[model samples]
Target: MSSTTLVIGGTGKTGRKVVQQLRALGEPVRIGSRRNSPPFDWENPATWPAALAGIDRLYVSFQPDLAVPGAAKAISDLTYLAVAGGVRKVVLLSGKGEQEAERCERIVADSGIPYTILRASWFSQNFSESFLMEPILSGTVALPKPEAPIPYVDTGDIAEVAVQSLLDDRHDGRIYELTGPRQLTFPEVVEEIAAATRRYIRYVPVPLEEYVEGLRNHDLPPDYVWLIGYLFGEVLGKPGNEDVSGDIERVLGRPARDFSDYVRETADSGIWNRVPSSS
Candidate 1:
């Protein structure tokens, strides 16, 4: 019998891929996004019990982020509802170095549910889809730090592991630290994209305060600003995690996708095709 899984953040990069993979595997997949059918919102606990009902497994990808305020409490409260609603297995998509995210992880660990935690590095899609995409398209990528080496992971790998964890019991109680095959600084990544698209992309390194001011001027959330600041300030430029993880290959029986592959794919997809201004 196939398991019925509720996939939260179903429209996100990893969650979307997970939903696709699960549906392809013939499992009953329920999308748990506020925008999707049977809306599931973290801020609204009243919706939890309904979404958790009949869900044997859950792929938990917290939106905006899990590191924000009240996330731990939300996860804790949801754990009770999940267990009460008969959810047996849960796979969480988490940031590798986030303390607030770790709090949510602990909530699930103690929730008596079969769980797998994927502590992922910065996603390669940040450039292709997220905040970095805007700057990349403008051809002037300016960040707080230029020397920061981010071991960005592909969302594809994260989704693959999440699906296995949800479908297979072998990954229970495991924490997987997922990263890219190689580490590249911000400037180096810009160069890679430039090399791939054959466009002259520029990387302007700014002070942390300047970066924050830039974001503030745009009315970006301070929570998002904190997340990015914590990441680039605390986690990046670390040497111990500079190499690719064996967890992806070990779990999937395949090599992790290279950064070059991600860049080439993004380039061919025509997602970044604006003719940059010369000024």
Candidate 2:
């Protein structure tokens, strides 16, 4: 019997794409999620063994983020469990320039199981598929730093690299810093979307504290608020995260998708023009 390849967070951005590519190749895959046959919840340990059972390979995409508190320990424990469970290979999706994310990378590296690390920049899909979507829909993209340019990588490229890493041992022990072809600040990103969708989306600069208060007004949890604050304030607000990387091209043997192309494609999908139904 072929060992099942377990994709943790399988329904999430990159995980879902990874699962799709793997299934397309006819690989035996078990999606590890709260809704799976043996549901896998990161906060729950008993769910670990059942999820790891009969799995030969694993793709780890930690939810919230690896920078959150206790994420390193969780990753370490989970990697240990995977090794003990006879899993041979592991591919970890990590964040670039985050110390905590690097710590989690070290955990996977030292796990004694062959592994690949994809330290990715911010995802481009945040504008369409995540928190920024609402602000985009509202026609105003507000953030703490409008000038900080991020080399936002595409989740699709990340997924492609992830699938290759899981199947090919050549990627083992390799740490690929995946980034987009260029950097774009929040304002520039909004401009691209506006041009692509032919809408008058504006970029507004909001203080970090005000952003947190706004999140609270929406009744978001404390941890979620902290995560968002950390991502924007500590990660994007800081310097040294805006460099373009050639690793995507090196690994996939193709140039990383440009932000303009992303905007154009996403715009063509009509997601940007979607109207919120009146409740």
Candidate 3:
């Protein structure tokens, strides 16, 4: 309880929730971000030790994602430094279906530091807070994998498990593959949102190549385009990823938030209905 925890990607979806919950509990939390007073940049290793200083526990949520190329090495290097910096425990957030993410998980496990791994499914917040938000607001949720149902876990569930892992040694050396209670396909997700918001929303299923080209037309960077293609084509396209785990209930003693609940709550927040201002 006396430990100061460092949250990498502190401003991110689950990272922000973790920081908020920890601070509300009067737990000492350090925001590890490139824009922080002492910036922590993933591409720059020099900023790492400064952020890890005086941090007893670490919550690592890698930016972009652990599935991207070079992520395993980065996690490896950071875990090595974290152990050397006297960090006692680490809770790493990882992608469930990504082989690259699993490789990064192995790096953290082999670092000689006590670790908890949350290999999580896709996030429910992606519809409200991430790249998918723009498409949803545009009334068309277009992408590949219209048939694949993803058990999108709530970011809050992920954060709660992370906090418990950071504080409890009992979770050490455990890998929790977290997900919601059910799976929802792209069209089903849109239907939920449309019902909740009373708006007309379309789920358009396009070819992977077309989706990539659309992203390019929108001027999304090439790296981002590749990441999207990898996620939709490789990760989501996998059949076994439609799994639901009891890890959220196991770790937090409560059921994970369903996608319908997420849609309803997010609708009340007006995020899906917000009108973009003229630039």
- Give the C-alpha miss distance for residue 129 in model 1, angstroms: 1.2
> Which of 1 and 3 is ahead in TM-score?
3
TM-score against native, each model: 0.94, 0.96, 0.96
Q: Write candidate 3's Cα lDDT for 76-102 as tens digits.
A: 889888888989999999898888688
RMSD of 3: 1.4
Candidate 2, residue 105: CA error in Å?
A: 1.2
| lDDT of candidate model 3 versus the reference | 0.89
Give the number of colliding residue pairs in candidate 1.
0
10 residues in a row with least lDDT, candidate 1: 235-244
Error of 2 at 223 (Å): 1.2
lDDT of 2 by residue, 1-279 (tens): 665799998999999999999999989999989999899999898899998989999999998899998898899889888878889999999888776678899888998999999999999998988888888888978888877889989999999999999999999999999999999888999988998999989999999899889998988978899888888877884667778889999989999988888898999999999984342
Better candidate number, 1 or 2, judged by lDDT: 2
- As a whole number from 0 to 100, the lDDT of residue 176 in candidate 2 is 91
